[model samples]
Target: MTLEAIFGMASLLAIFSWIALFIFYPSKWIYQTLFSGVLIVLGIMYLFYLFTGIGSLADFNFDSLEQVRTVFSSDEALLAGWIHYLAFDLFVGMWISKDSWEKNISRWVLLPCLLFTFMMGPIGLMLYFIVRAIKTKKLNQSPFH
Candidate 1:
């Protein structure tokens, strides 16, 4: 397969995995099996691209943001960056699902967090923290405590 095709396929797979997780709320199978499997594949692709495809970590000049942009100029390097986002975002989504379930927060609340996590990594995570804080505070204030 071409590099572009591989990138597209991997991206789609990660996206579908996120939707599956949301649709099947609290599903251990989705989080543990499907998501985990996709992450492992993405991780291997990341390493492969890093070592044999475009460039190496040595190419990145930590001293300057401009140098960092220069290093990711290659198609392979860009894909690697994208794959990095996919892996981490999916991992975060899984964590959000598991944590929300454990906290007894409804799936309705988690849906947006999962979607945001997929679309814009840190924003989704930040939203989840807000949700958790509110839920936790309410629990603490219950007169039945």
Candidate 2:
């Protein structure tokens, strides 16, 4: 398959996995496994593309936006970057779902975080943390002591 096909498949899987986890199934270990597998596939595909081309991991620079843009000018480089986002963001989304469930946070609260994570990654992580913290604080407070 072409790089674009792989990219699209991975992207769709990542997005669908998170949304399905949030909506259809919660606390399913198999879903977590499936999502992690997709992440690993994307990472491996990106690494493979980097190896075949000129994306030197040992000397990659991120000192400036222009430099980053230059690096991602190549199709392989861009896909690699996209896969990086897919892997990390999906992992974070998975974590949020699992952790929130353990803490008994409502699914409604996690849905927004998961959606944001699928779209913007770190922002979703931050939002989930904020919500988690607030819920945790509420749980710790005395109701009528």
Q: Top lDDT: which candidate number?
A: 1
Query: Which residue pairs does candidate 1 place in steric collision?
Result: none
Candidate 1 local lDDT, residue 124: 100
**Model 2 alpha-carbon drift over 4 Å, by segment:** 23-25, 53-59, 138-145
Tens-digit lDDT track of model 2 for 13-132: 777767667775465764556566766787788787666544576546678997777677788778877878887887777778778877789888888898898899889988887887
The 0-to-1 C-alpha lDDT of every candidate, in the order given, reads: 0.82, 0.75
How well does model 2 score by local distance difference test? 0.75
Residue pairs in collision within model 2: none
Q: Model 2: how far is 4 from its true place, Å?
A: 2.2
Model 2: how far is 140 from its true place, Å? 13
- Encode model 1's per-residue lDDT on 25-133: one tens digit a residue: 5776787676568889999988776555455567766578888787677777778888889999998888888888888999999999988999999999989888987
